[model samples]
Target: MTTSTQIQRLAIVTGASTGIGRATAVRLAADGFHVLAGVRKRSDGDRIASSRIEPIILDVTNDEHIAALVERVAQDPAGRPLSVLVNNAGVAVNAPVEVLSLDDWRFQFDVSVFGQIALIRALLPTLLSTRGRVLNVTSVGGRVAMANFGAYSAAKFAMEAVSDSLRREVEPFGVAVVKITPGAVSTNLTESGLAAAARVTDTMTPEQRRRYAELSRAFIAQAEGFARDGVSPEHAAAVISKAVNARRPKTRYTIGRDGAMFTFMPRIVSDRLLDAMLRSQNKSLAQEKR
Candidate 1:
């Protein structure tokens, strides 16, 4: 029989197969919570599992996976109460809105927007019972939409709104919702986004490619720089752990210098000014690459 003292706080972290998710899972475990690290593949699950971190096969977009996760929380073997849900699963499909296919757009929203909401809705009952918190890992693009990040930015912006709405709805009931926006954490996301962009470029017509090829190249170069100069997954994870453990956590947290700038600068700068600044930066980066 599980004793009351044996019960531990439980945290569910999606996208735990790599990067920020993996780091967050490890950090939370070290902080004494039993983390249910969600991964889509068994190999990934095996890779992240540890004494305090159990791996769960969870594709947030899948109804069955979400249901299984809810069931797992409901019947914890150690009677651990659900404490936090980290919605970190996301994909970046960077291509101009005019050139990106509807399928790609759907895929981006499916993973980032719909998937997060699906999991939240499925787990809300248990979370409400435990007065748990929800942490959404949004992006700087959410605040300042870029030239080629239409789909990704749109989804992140939607999540930002959802986080606000949910927070207001659940705050009176003791639940907190926090958003973590990272500037450019050193992760596999850049490589993945570039690959997706390449595919979209291939599908573009000659005229379309002629119009946007140089810009895409610049975007690629800048994205690479962002990854190279960004903070580590461990650093982002540490900040997340701090938020998780804070008695009165802030509604939003920015990970790096760029993260803080992009999050707050948009509030002060005019849209045209931001556009001009981004265009100049992109042009310089493109010229450098050439």
Candidate 2:
């Protein structure tokens, strides 16, 4: 396999600005892949350009950026086939269903689900030819909705559904689909998601605000704790590297201690028991009003 990589070992990683995506891109490059690291900001691209990675502007939600990426891959000097596509670009929303603005919900799905589908669609020809893999970087929330995380979980759940269907459909073609579910990955995503949720809180009516006050406060603290407890993004990147190189990778890889525990527990417990366990973990909601 090491010798075969010389044929066309190109890989594209979206959301390479920071976190797991950046780490994965760097790791793949170290493993001898011609990595195209995608970022939405010029500063991000500049930061990663120092490495062997070739950074490109890729806002996954934008059709134009997707098109540009396709063309860039198509024009590979070696005309090399894309060996892998890492759909790591995503946004998060923290509002409850009642007040989750329609736009917020749409925005969550826009990047995580719809944009990924579009990327796969445009890149399918290349992927099929190369018999490459598609790795969707999802969350533990995809398997089990977390408290106060309906908007983000909903998007990830949908991503899981499509990935399942896609795997079956493309397996015959030698194209693989794998989901990377990281639990509380120590990334800026937690901060950004909580901040976005705060904005949603501001837009609420006084009555609505009061209704959400307690749980929302708990939720914010919960997100912070999750971020603090998370393992380094490099650990998650290592798991992703394994997935890309495995002869027959598992359907999913869950990173972090919490990620592994959550994934395992869900399989053995009944749904009702799982709900009880989840609620037990939501002790933040039990804190007395301050």
Candidate 3:
């Protein structure tokens, strides 16, 4: 028989196969919560190091998987209640709107917006039972849009609205909704985005391809350069852990120096000037090729 003492606080972290999701799950387990680490691949589950973590196969984009996860967490022994849900599973679709396909746009919102909201809805009962918190691991793009990131950033921006709305609604019931926006974190996201962008380029007409050339080149360079300069996933993970344990968590946590700058600077800076700066970045890439 399971005793009350044997039960532990639970945290469900999506995209636990890599980067911030993986780091957060590891850190939470270290901090004494039994983490439900959601990974899409069996091989990834094999890589988690903590005994307190149960690596569950979960793909946020799959409806059946989301339902099954809800059912699985609901079966936790009588005394164990879920304390947190980290919506971290996401894909980046990086391309200018002119070059972006309809399918790519749908996939971006499907994973980061619809799928995440569905999981949260399914898990809300379990969360309310424990008066738990919701942590959305978003990107710096969520706050300030940039060239070639419209699709991905749109989804994150939508998520920011969702986070705010949910935060207000859930707070009266003692549930907190927190958003963690990190900038240029060392992760597989950029590589994945670039891969998707390559496929988009392959499908483009000659004119569209030429039109997007400068933006694509600049995007690739920026992503690669940021990978070298970005903070580690551990930095984001630590903020998440702190948010999880705080008596009164803030509405958002900007995880790095770059994150804080990108998220807040847009509010004070003029839109026209920002657009000029971003356009200049693309021009600089074209100049490099000349």
Please report the candidate that would top lDDT against the real structure: 1
For 1-290, candidate 1 gives per-residue lDDT tens digits of 22233237899999999999999999988888899999989999998888989999998889999998889999999788999999999999999999999999999999999999999998888889999999999999899998999999999999999999999999899999999999989999888888999888989899998999679879988888978898999999999998998889999999999999999998899999999999998898888678
**TM-score of every model?**
0.97, 0.93, 0.94
Candidate 3, residues 24-83: lDDT per residue as tens digits?
998888777888999989999999946788999998878899888888887886456798
Winner on TM-score (2 vs 3)? 3
lDDT of 2 by residue, 49-130 (tens): 8544899999888999999999999998876779999999999888878888899888998988899999999998899998
Question: Model 2, stretches more than 4 Å misplaced?
Answer: 1-8, 285-290
Q: Candidate 3, residue 249: CA error in Å? A: 0.5
Find the 10 residues in a row with the least total lDDT in model 2. 281-290
**Candidate 3 off by > 4 Å:** 1-7, 285-290
- The Cα error of candidate 1 at residue 192, in Å, is 0.6
Cα error of candidate 3 at position 261, Å: 0.7
Query: Model 1 off-target regions past 4 Å?
Result: 1-7
